[model samples]
Target: MQNIQHPMFALSLIFSFILVTHAFLYFISSLFSNSNYWFYFLAQECILFISAFILPNGSPTVLIGLLPVLIAQSIIILKNKLKVILFFMLSYGLYCIAITINYGASELPIFIPIFFLILLIVIVYTISYNRQVSARERMEFYLQQLELAYQKVEELTLSNERQRMARDLHDTLAQGLAGLIMQLEAVNVHIKNGNISRSNEIIVSSMQQARETLKDARTVIDNLRTETLEYMDFHSAVLDEIKKFEEITGIDVEQEIKPIHSLSNLSMEYGIYIIRESLTNIMKHSQARKVKIKIEQKDGKIYMEVSDNGIGFSIKNIGKQTGKFGLLGLQERIRLVGGGLTIESMPGKGTKLFITVPI
Candidate 1:
């Protein structure tokens, strides 16, 4: 159907063009045979034809000049083509006869003006078309650049997510498995020493540790399944971590968190993870009796403090310990989100970690 309609439209356009051409020819014939009107009509027709060849799209100046030709044709035709054609032929023969009788003795200079007009039309049309084409090409180039920039942003986002997952695994599940493995190895050595009862107890403890390690690993994976951090409530997620910490270490835990109405998930999740990892390090290394966790908002920023009343180590000695990735990962996470983490402790005094993240 579209193909048929397209041909019909093309035919209509062709018919319109033929009608216009016929009208122009008849109007030219109606002008005077020996007067200035005949010369004027011929001159205007020359301009229109040159414009069509040069501009391709007719100019307003050219159309204005062509108007007299159109009017003369209309007067001769009287809306009937047969009569108009007979009168047109008679008028043309008379015009040629008058020209031969009046100006046959000399060469006319009329063609000079027509030649310059045509040249001007061609130059202006070529410049305008080239400029329009260049403008369109420039617009397309900018659009392609914008598309590439958006793609790069998407790729960087995916890369950051993968790095976060790796850091989480290294800090939580990987460390848990290492501890469990060490306990199992100790049990095996005890069995080789011929201490049957102690070996049995060590075996039982190692099994329990393995079970806990597997459960923690599963929790990490489950949490990762949620693409957006907003899927979990900040307070509830923090409490879950506290519960896990208490279950694993038998430490008394206390938490005080202030409500934030319009907290962004990115800031909240990162803050919670930082606090969780800090507490995990404390539980595994510090022989503390009680732990206090506090979260508060002030001046458009979230501040968290996790401190334990345990045998503390020097902050300067962090890199010296082999099991210090947890602290390093916490630092990296805080840095990723434009936040800061600070650790303060002495050899016998307790350790205190203060983290501040802007929302």
Candidate 2:
């Protein structure tokens, strides 16, 4: 009975020492922000060391205390590498000393290998934890960079939209007003020369142009309110524009529109506007009796060609002509959608516009 109770009493003392020392360490850490707080763990190690020597048959239980210290060291944030290593070595040395003293020196071969194995596992866990922390930090950094890039893109988009709006106004309202002024001046001259028939004809033409300009302005406003192709598909929209061009200019149109399987709304909207502007330029300046338009989707891109047998001018000098805003607007529209445009023309030969946009 005495022997059984003595072993049980030793077990109780071992567990009580572990629990009380850990609790005290927790309390000190929680209540104080001391830089030398890790010393408390060393002090707990010393207490366990002294207690092991005094307790009878305490050598086997010494491992129970040593394992908890090693595991705690592995999990903690290691600020001081040298101090942590020193603490580990001290704990190991004291464990070895206690084992040799209580369990005899011959057991060193068996327990030493086991201790190193446990230490290796602890080292592996520490390395894995550090790698996870580094990976999480890198992911956070990448997310921040992406957020900044998105903001830059959003700002650039708004600036482009403002420029597009200005171009639309120049193409529609400003040019319409300028044309009306020129026609009115011509009407004044004809009336002064007593050419009533010619004056009436000029007035009629000016009225028609005014009506068309007003319609174009309304179309611009409607575009601002909603998407231009919300109700119409690409094919029908292009056909409608071709029909309108024929009726307005009395020019014969040769058109070949292939089936477009996939196109973004942005591409379709800009493409239609480019076509309409091209036809307007033909009517006003080209003086061409025949026009050809071809639209197709090939090689992951939308291709459009507008050709006319018109009295074309030099592409270089076209930029100097203040009234020639059509080409500039076309280029701007193409650029906005990450597309390209090529103009082929000479002083007398026909003019051709080639537009390409990715699907």
Could you say which candidate leads in TM-score?
2
For 186-242, candidate 1 gives per-residue lDDT tens digits of: 878888888789878877887887787777666566446335455777777778788
TM-score of each: 0.44, 0.46
Cα error of candidate 2 at position 247, Å: 22
Candidate 1: stretches off by over 4 Å: 1-216, 222-228
For every model shown, the clashing-pair count is 3, 0
Q: Each model's C-alpha lDDT?
A: 0.65, 0.77
RMSD of each: 16.3, 9.8
Whole-model lDDT, model 1 = 0.65
Residue 204, candidate 1: C-alpha displacement in angstroms:
11
lDDT of 2: 0.77
Off by over 4 Å in 2: 1-76, 79-83, 97-109, 147-155, 181-199, 222-359
Extract clashing residue pairs from model 1: 26-73, 27-72, 27-73
Candidate 1: deviation at residue 113, Å?
Answer: 43
Window of ten residues with lowest summed lDDT in model 2: 221-230
